[model samples]
Target chain A: MTTTNGLPPTGKSARIELVCPAGNLPSLRAAVDNGADSVYIGLRDNTNARNFGGLNFELPAARDGLDYAHRSGTKVLLAINTYPQPATWQRWTRAVDTAAGLGFDAVIIADAGLMRYAVRTHPQLRIHLSVQGSATSYEAINFYHRHFNVRRAVLPRVLSLAQVEQVIRNTPVEIEVFGFGSLCVMVEGRCALSSYVTGESPNMTGACSPAKAVRWEQKASGLEARLNGVLIDRYGANENAAYPTLCKGRFKAGDDVYYAIEEPASLNALELLPELDRIGVAAVKIEGRQRSPAYVAAVTRVWRQALDACAQGTAAPQPRWSEELRRMSEGQSHTLGAYHRPWK
Target chain B: MKLALGPLLYYWPRQSVVRFYEEIARSSVDIVYLGEVICSRRHELRLSDWLDLAAALEAAGKEVVLSTQALTESESDLRTLRRIAGNGRFPVEANDMGAVNVLAGAAPFIAGPHLNVYNPHTLSVLAGLGVRRWVMPVEMPRHVLEDMQHARPAGVETEVLAFGRLPLAFSARCFTARRNNLPKDDCRFSCIDHPDGLPLDTLEGAPFLVLNGIQTQSAHVHCLIADLDDLAGLGVDAVRISPQSRHTADVIALFRQRMIGALDAAAAARELEQLAPGATCDGYWRALPGMTPPGNAP
Candidate 1:
């Protein structure tokens, strides 16, 4: 099942867009300055999935990014992707209104209610169904497209490249897929592992393994990281530390105790750029809004050149390109993730 | 409130599954949801076999609704879903949007717990698409359900997960298979061993979660036998008791008795704790962290 794209020729001319993430104002600028064709951002509240400490844009900062991205010829997509609580729906609706008022190019959303709000309130507002929404098939994606008039849908990380091309051939909607950054083992919106431990999640509260529930202490044997009093990991002296997320942590399962769900790693899909373009993928996304601006700059710059190479008919530069990205990955490692079935 | 038996989350032997439903058919359960909602590979019962079982249950005067998979990534999963949706005997529960696409604008189908229905607008939209009822995700708080109920669409029913180990999450990677060092595609149906689920503990030996193939469930069963009055007060239409390995019928009878004023909340709580697989918690209903039992201060 190689990438023999069955989708009608995407004109052999449509330049695939490079979408990047922004955690804060600086990161937003870093994405724009580093050749990102479009930048996705989240507001400074639970309305967005990346609501972490001292991160995300407040109203004024969002206004600035909106202006800056438009002036720089880079599109801005606001990620109000979290499911708003019943009492909290008003805030989410207001967030959509704010996005429309600020002239954001699109609003990435997961919750159906929020999509309804955005659609009814500002019908012209372009909507991109977030991967957090968990629409994994063309049937699912088409449901959203027909009902809500969604312009594009971000593919969940669970699909292989063959499955992706199969979906593209079936649906009229534009497809955006994750290219690089921290990987979620579970389907995005459907997961509640974070809230099950920390009372926070990307779906319900827009936070995952929040820092407040995180505690790190150096013991005699190793450094221990715990989330809400549950020990996630213990690292021996000289062992590099990784963030304590329930999915990434080591645990006792059957006779073997290991990183039972997934290891601390990031997803880098630069190697598949040409194949992704041939499959008619409209955009390739970078997935870290909880990262530093330097991290954003390093990843965005590398992917930008790789994407341009497909147009130049040049092979993507070798070991150096991968080594530079490895330095930015979680645990300094990268996998093509679900794109290649062996990672599963 | 109405009582529903959610689709069994475990992969029991075919005989066990058939016998379980045979007992449920004679029990007090009003709605019986049947299907392979967790992993598509669990083949003890095929879709036709499920429909055959559905016929037996429905013949015994029970409402039947077949449920789709929680994670429908493959084309085969969708094919099975289309068959279930087009079963034409009873309503179908749309667990994923693929199921929704097939069931929409035809017959009224259920919006299963995996669908995110936290707000009134999403509820209204689903109602328009012919959702007769929607299950509350296990982690939703009571107040959120109440708010949605206040503005719920007409003819729409609200169902809350009342009992059993709460399914916290699902993934493409199978933890149960991985625990045995088996690749996902080549997994040897290891989930059938643990009829309840494989319990995962922390380093200090505190039970945290249960691994059931690709699904992760709560270590403690979410017992809402004591919260019946609160549920009634909030106008909740149905309370679903997920199928566990043991004492499920007694759990159903207890809810039936409590609903008919035969039992009080305190006594029901005591009896339910003894029947549950582990400790009982209702922290999600109280809006605290899900692990903490309700009424305990955070």
Candidate 2:
């Protein structure tokens, strides 16, 4: 069968693994019960990238979620993805130990030191390189695999479909691509726009446009979204306001005021399943670990159905799937993200 | 401390690019990094042209290091990267791990700031892969850098971005082209028009970011000319001054004079503020918001 990018099938699994996000126990259950092959979670600290308030798993809830996911035959991966401060380095190392002690399937990590610690200490714990690790090329993926024995890598949302296929074709490590969620216009982990405005960043603080730094002020002109008191965007009365991510917010370039970097659109790659499956992608990851359980269930359900349908020879994404996903998308719309070269 | 010129980030006209290096050869800078670190679509100076310039700069008594693209996206980009990695004459500064992978064990190289070497262990890991020196990620705070300097392995040297607008982020989408309302593939090289990057401002007319093709930079210049003494105390070996469209030579002179104690730190800083395109900030050095000037944040 002909593929989208013209690469012949590698005779891999017809049904790819569907990895889902779980911020808390209910979200974990939502992902697990809704047919996620694997579920990823973060600890309730700055060690992981999704350290939002009222989100992620605390110790007790983590144990319960681990038990539930294991009982449901779904693997649980703990994300220890943020870079550790030199003063607080041990906290991140301890997090890896916590994940291993909890009987977690694997540890998704970004810092090389933590990876070294995991490799030396746990020895048997599978290491999946976080997208925050920024291993965009096959050689880079192979570097982590060679040094730390990293088994799987979630690619940063920068590569085109052909580039993703090139990486998968070249590396022995399992490849995971973002299937659906809010789009990060910049390369993951490499961006510092948030920290540039606010002192906190996803790399250092595990939060981008951290909730505490965000302030909303209603003015006669419009509602202004500010991060650390810097005006990110001002919305009109009838306009749909997106979260004030430094990239997605509107700004002025020359004479025109627009979303100069990127518009507020979520990534929905349901149509690219056949190409992803054809290219031998081991897993398709959904991007919101800080999202609600309902969002998790809704996105996971659509992707799960779509993946299954693709296995059964569905060529295009169903209209209903796109409609359902668009409702849950940020800005009430979705784009194919960097998968399509033109989107770049 | 030695003064190093960072890779020219903007897509200058070929004559302007060549002339910039010719001026650099006579400048007070000790090291010169050549080649594209931003978009691959910029073809005014190809790999051969960079090597020729590197050789010319080397002959002119400056230490030369070749820099790879910060984000490697296409097969053509990879081919250019492979050639840069394999360029036996010069040590390559690895901007991505892909470059690190290709250059590792082949020869010792410089780990560019974009590689995200946050802690000593990550530093040691790259050091193990033959990194001779590492440029600190620009947003890294002072305390973290002090800790890294203390714990750095014996052979590795540390460098900091001492001047120029901070490269805040990189995207697959060409923001410059997007601003011009052109597709990336047919961008018509719009970045050439803005030698200092297309300025992006907030709705209230506050300078926010500068868009240069696929890379975004802080609109405020990050000036640490006054902090050279502090950097020396922290064991920093060198400081990089990114090339701006105008007054780079004067900026280099000010830094050189400060290094030799001929120019007072405060005087040099005041002089640098005049030379920079926009207002100056050293907040990243002080570990505050990157745009905050020291003692100026509300």
Candidate 3:
């Protein structure tokens, strides 16, 4: 094992949960075999936010993963985060029942009705408000806490460090902030650009940049990427063509044709872990349910070492940590992303 | 079956905004959503001015709803929201859960589009919390709406963004200010320059998006005048006509005529398209890509 269970805080600051993503059985083992305090996975169906085919877990796999994590004395959080359509509302409620029945640690949810049902039906089961719920303020976080008795709330990636601290200072619920992964740029649960082009979105369909609509072409001029029928980006000679997610697309805003909203970069908050610890962020989440086991192994290893050293009062963001993180990032790059005021 | 004026998405001069609502007070729209829903810094109209206009619209035989900011961050923003919800005048529209916190159980409010109320169970919970009406999220298709209507909580009216450029996304980074090479704190009100929002085109020279402060809307207007009968069948209580700088009065009248059966879908779409900013698309209503307009099939 490259890391410990990560349940007890090793740093001088409070115990901060290192919540990691587990898209499949191997990724879940990579996280548990390394050092995730808790690992969150989704169902294979569209009931979960990461509804990509050939990814995520089936009922048997989910039950198995829960058994593996619980036996290792690690927590397993099930993500039933996508907003269910009226016709499919029963599926979400049933997922909640399944998660509770499986004796999972907590169910991370986004829909209001789902939370209400979870709290009413499974009163003993803990609820962590999913980031897809997009609660950025203390009042909003408190609303969930007051009504549904949510034990934790994942703050959206839009707030700055100072704003995050302010939100923590005012709310009673445990706060979980994004530690690493692809940035949504736009507010999650609100973006429609993917659906506008691909007719699928995280809020409705539980998928962003659905695979069916993506097309790549090597034309005479450059490498071009298109979503549905709309051309998202074109690359020049010797340039790396990053995956065409809607927010990261290069488009024309005014006179300058550039990354209009956000550049093609991943968010790495490794440097801010110290500050986040001082601010009392109860957990740090890593995004990527669609990533492979190798990707998870590399990221989870670095984060585990750093977080452990920080808990032991020996934390130094070693040079190798950033270098490793950079190699695995989108476009081989990363940013603080709205944590610094200039980015906002 | 009914017409409601949505909150204006773009920032305009104070006089122009006042005049736009002054005309709206006498228009065919039955309900009017007021206030700056995009940017908290767009102080062209103060809270008092919005309240006064709400009073004026109520006097003109219209129901008034106060709309809150889509993204509430700063302390001042929350302070403004608490005041708006507790203002004791009209039903407040909770755009975000921050607004819902202030209005929960104390006053009845409309669950604005930003609330992300997609399924019936969420609607049922909000109805329990005193949400009298809720605007369906913009990107939802007709079948989703039909499903929601089937399991909808009792007595809560549903509104849809039946007209105008669909608001695709909102961000903390103000794209309008970013386009002008300015920081958000020192934006200097550049969003006022484009009353209908600054347009963005694709590299292929195709019209793409509209940048209004922190919001990105579709370049082409989204018209559902062609689907009024379908909305009625789906039990949509109100059809929202989002405010545009030009010919919004005409948009309202056209929608109103269709709502009352004074005009058929074919004639209504033709008249409505004449007043649209660019072209019109209703693909999302038909469960297709939002930018793809359902062709003239009716």
Candidate 4:
């Protein structure tokens, strides 16, 4: 059978699906209209990975979004990606029950225990391992598959394209890689820097650089946005300052201060579409459910054009929309990240 | 309660690692987890040496558990993980789920702290898959553990990270190697220079974090000596004292003394602070910011 992204069943030039993040209904529609083959969203609770204010979907909104995506022949994946506490597993269980009841395609999960529960309680529900789970190797992916019968895995961003290719070749599971958005320096599902400073962990609470912990203060030097009482960046009066995630902060390393973990930039690997498709990546994920609908539309449109070009055995098309995307990026900068080994 | 000395989080000389465990064999610790848990580039102690050390510790009447690297970035990492999981000797502590899968149903194992077992259902699932004991995630509070314990399967014992600098996060990029202007692949075992992790100070020169290769830890060493009563009350089966460069054995002794009521909380806390490589904080166990002192508990 042909995969959703329109690649033939040969598996040689595997069809690459464009998976976009939809924090709200507007973004969901934008993604579907612009060419996202599938969209992933989470409920407006701790059950979802993007547990931020003014983001994510309420139950009604989520059900409506799923219905819309389904009508358009686009798949919708529900992310119940946070690790549940002993007293709070029911909240997650209910989320799984809701997703299955609502006729969503799959639930993206991070916790092994929760994965087992989801596979057992909702045996018909397809499972995709969340990138937050930090499955970095064939062994980890195989473990999830053997135990929870996970159908796919959203590979961690740290892996190179070659590594991704190796993982895809070795396992029966479909491999998903981040094609764009904020490059997390730390492993996604396992990081606790935000929680260490703000009493909320990404793994346990499903948030990082959480909105509540962020505060913008005006100083003599410029504007400063701090996260968890630490000044992440101090921009001059005319210079633009990005929202300070801990990793994307300017810090002193010995005598000089620079963006030690990462420059305040997002990943826009538009140039690597053909390579990713050639390497047999089943799907490409765009990070940032916290982004605006316009941002989702622009990114989805550019990637859609590129994917269509790659499918036709043409030179991969470049969407000359970098200026539009720059406005939406963290600090108007971008990188290919570990995919090209630029950092190395 | 049986004590398990967690893997030496820092990179030291191979001889230092051997000597540390040799000394640990004589201490109050019942189990010892040996191997490189931080960056796999640290080859001061090869797998053969780690296996040899595990045998020595086991012969000394302590249970031994070999630990795999927390961040596995290469095929070599997987090969090492497979070897440790298939060693067929002492149990392996599956730090990452990769190791857990390798050890799953092959033999019983210890789920390390990095596995993030925060709830009971997960605990039950792990117990079913041959995990005999599991270490609680560092930031989980006492009450959460109590709730989990109430639902935990009968045979699985619970362990807490009782003492040492709290491991806050691990990354693919090595901060310690980066600081020394080295690539992670060619880190040259730079983390060995910082016996305790390399202290990272804020712009104002306030100590904030400690860099241990790929692992970032709290600069404030976590001391739960004052919480022995609380730990006992929670029915915690073991208190894991992570090894530091200085006075680790003495710190273990202080916990032993406090556990048996030979010392009060005040005395134990004071001794722990004095023996600490830096300032002491138990904020993780208290569910507060990791750097906050007990006096500032919210």
* Model 2, CA-based lDDT: 0.91
Worst 10 residues of 4 chain A by lDDT: A4-13
> TM-score, each model?
0.97, 0.98, 0.96, 0.95
Stretches of model 3 off by over 4 angstroms after superposition: A1-13, B296-298
The sequence of per-residue lDDT tens digits that candidate 1 reaches over residues B178-246 is: 888888888889999999999988776778889999899989888788888889899999999989989
Error of 3 at A200 (Å): 0.9
TM, chain A, every candidate: 0.95, 0.97, 0.95, 0.93
Docking tier of model 3: it is: medium
For model 4, report DockQ. 0.59
Name the top TM-score candidate. Answer: 2
Worst 10 residues of 3 chain B by lDDT: B289-298
List the DockQ of the predictions in order.
Answer: 0.77, 0.84, 0.76, 0.59
TM-score of 3: 0.96
Q: On lDDT, who's better, 3 or 4?
A: 3
Candidate 4 residue-wise lDDT, A1-344, digit = tens? 65444544336436889999999999999999898999999998998778988889888898889888988999999999889998788998899998899999999998888888889888999999999888898888998999899999998877877777778778899989998888887777767777667778888778787887889989777787877776777788877777778777776755766666667778877778777877788889999898899989998987788788788877455446566656667777878877876353
Regions more than 4 Å wrong, model 4:
A1-13, A317-324, A342-344
- Estimate how well candidate 3 is docked, as a DockQ score: 0.76
Error of 1 at B138 (Å): 1.3
Candidate 2 per-residue lDDT, tens place, B20-87, comes to: 99999999899999999998889998899999999999999999999999998777888989999888
Best by lDDT: 2
Give the per-residue Cα lDDT of candidate 2 at B215. Answer: 92
